[model samples]
Target: MTNTQHEPRLFADEAAIRRVGEGLIARTLPREDWTHEAHLAACAWIVRMRPDIAPERDLPAIIAAYNEAVGGVNDDAQGYHETITQCFIRAVRLHLARAGQADLPTLVNGLLAAPEGQRDWPLGFYSRALLFSVAARRGWVEPDLAPLPTVMEA
Candidate 1:
């Protein structure tokens, strides 16, 4: 679940989103700046601008490398999480499709305003215990609660 201790950070424009994405790609974003909102921002930027890199196929390595660069570990307990990353990527893709031709910042803001952008969104699909399990963290675990929806359901 998202750490609700802090308020969600909103991007002022596309440049803010691009900064998060490019920083993530370059492994240069400050670790503390990689908040949950920042994750969605980066995903939105990638989905909108870097079509050449399929997020589902390529983000795992990128995230893992970034974690290492930021002095974090990609172990079962922390760093890259396969299930969470994949789920958000799917959600971001759906948001992008729904937001055709919109500016990148608007697309991202719309996504952040959606229910799927909530940190606890996956909880609607997977049980808390299962979603937080090491197995789920290391690999994709089929949702144990309600099924994840297709883009058509968005």
Candidate 2:
């Protein structure tokens, strides 16, 4: 796969993202996924930029391998997450702009970086969500925490 810096960005809404988070918690982290190449890449990036986050071994592959053994994987989790992050970042910036809270990116990054050795966390899905949430609370992105509306029978 080529670098994404040259590729166009992808974005998604809150519902799908929450669903992705759930997927991560259920399918990937606890069990694992087969197509973990993407996860592997993401992990490598985190490790490369912040060695403190790097595991002693290939964590993403291990997680993916584990989830794949579960015999079921949701194909859309990564797609949803990517979409949410891109859009969430934009949304947070816009929200801050309206409220006159500038320097949104720096604040959110700092929030994400608060915990030491956060990358060493065994669970990638949880870490990713944790990072996003901390960012949201810190104004790195908007809290789109939209829920899937409940249905009421008439």
Q: After superposition, how far is residue 146 of candidate 2 from its true place, in Å?
A: 40
Task: Kindly report which residue stretches of model 1 are placed more than 4 angstroms away from their true locations once superposed.
Answer: 1-6
The sequence of per-residue lDDT tens digits that candidate 1 reaches over residues 45-82 is 88779988889988999999999999999997999999
RMSD of each: 1.9, 17.6
* Span of ten consecutive residues with least summed lDDT in model 1: 1-10
Best by lDDT: 1
Clashes of each: 0, 8
- Global lDDT scores for all candidate models: 0.87, 0.32
lDDT of residue 106 for candidate 2: 35
lDDT of 2 at 141: 34
User: After TM-score superposition, what is the CA distance of residue 17 in candidate 1 from its true location, in Å?
Assistant: 0.8
lDDT of 2 by residue, 25-138 (tens): 345433332222223223323332335533323333334444565664424432223333333223323333333442423333332232211232212223446444534322
